[model samples]
Target: MRILVSNDDGIFAEGILALIRAVADLGEIVVVAPDQQGSASSHGISLHRRLVPKPVDLQIQNVEAWSFSGTPVDCVKFGVTQFGEQHPFDLMLSGINEGRNLATDVLYSGTIAAAGEAALQGIPALAVSLDGPPFPFDEAAQVVRKMVDRLQFKTLDADTFLSVNIPAESVDGPWVVTRIGAEGYRDRFIRHTDDDGQAYYRYVGDVVRNIEDDDSDITVVNKGCISITPLRYRFTNEPAMDTLKTWF
Candidate 1:
């Protein structure tokens, strides 16, 4: 299988290298990733600026890599539109990310956004992340390898992709299919004055978990299980349509 790999954590991050090592035996691997960190960039694309993708002299066995001066979504877009024409990819994998992207965190994750972009282009995609302060990328990569192997034979919808979150403690737990959870960081900003008396604000927040919901991705990961949540690009709220139609 031909595979394309990309990440939001930049091209030199250990997470992306671990991902490459984990799936090296799968097929031909081509990587297009951001040149710098893009953690909370979401699905943002660099529309008004010149996107420069430069070839990187990476020594990973049997892999070609490039670094892009754009968002993670731009990497996938370039991969699909340019490199894909020469060698169509069977799958697109994004990140063994430094931190877990679960619940509402997916809304701000460039890692998940890369996979989502691939799904939009009709390619099978998966975004893998791990919970970490001390990122155990090697262990997470092993789990990702097994998951990728299993996914090789499975058929997924063209419009959907998988967002996987692995617990940092262990990879021995069962894999669970889950829904997006309500857990998110409560918004908080600290106002500060600069030396010149200029006011500035810094964003900060605590992760709030919805413990009552067991079927959510956050809960499953917290319980030491791998959480695989299938996601689609559609944002339409179908249930609210009828309520608005009554007014019309």
Candidate 2:
């Protein structure tokens, strides 16, 4: 299998390197990732600016890598359209990210966005993240490698992808399939004055609240089990559309 790898943590990050090491024996690997971290960039593409992709020497045996001066989504776009056109990737794997993208946090994650971009192109994809202050990247990568090996047997919808979160410490049990959690971090901003007396707001809030659902991603991860949440790009509210039809 030919696999395309990308990440929001940039190409030189230890997480990505660990990911490459874990899956190197599986198949041919090509990496296209951001030169700098694009953490909460979501699925943003560089529409107005010119994207520059430069060849990077990772010195990893049997892996060709490139660093793009754009977001994680841009890396996926370029990797699929350019390199994939030549080699034809069987799967696209993003991250082994430095931190967990749990619950609604995936909505703001560039790591998950990269995988989403690949799924949009009809390629199978998965985003891997580790919940951490001290990230256990090797363990996370091992989990991801096993998942990748078994992905061929699983069936997913055209625009669907998987978002995986692993505990930084040893897991208590086996991995669990979970639903996306409705819970998220409460938005809070701190008002501050600059040295020049200019008032500004700084985003500061680490408090996360998870929904009561036991099958939710947040709940599952907190229980020390690896969470695998299947996600799709469709945002249409079908039930709402039927209710709104009466107004017309």
Could you estimate the TM-score for every candidate? 0.96, 0.94
Candidate 1 C-alpha error for residue 101, in Å: 0.7
TM-score, model 2 to reference: 0.94
Candidate 2 minimal-lDDT segment of 10 residues = 203-212
lDDT tens digits by residue: candidate 1, 1-248: 88999999999999999999898888789999999999999999998999998999778777889999999999999988888987789999999899999888899999999999999998999999988766889888998889888988999988999999988886768999999998778889999999999999999978876664788897888898999999998999999999999989
**Candidate whose TM-score is highest:** 1
- Summed backbone clashes in each candidate are 0, 0
Task: Record all residue pairs in model 2 with backbone atoms less than 3 Å apart, i.e. clashing.
Answer: none
Kindly provide the TM-score of model 1 when superposed on the true structure, using C-alpha atoms.
0.96
Deviation from truth (RMSD, Å), model 1 = 1.3
lDDT of each: 0.91, 0.89
Q: Give residue 79's lDDT in candidate 2 (0 to 100).
A: 91
| Pairs in steric clash, model 1 | none
Candidate 2 error regions (>4 Å)? 193-197, 206-208
Superposed by TM-score, candidate 1 places the C-alpha of residue 94 at a distance from the truth, in angstroms, of 0.6
Candidate 2, residues 136-226, lDDT tens digits: the string is: 7887898898888888778788899999999887543579999988776777899999999999998875767644589988888888889
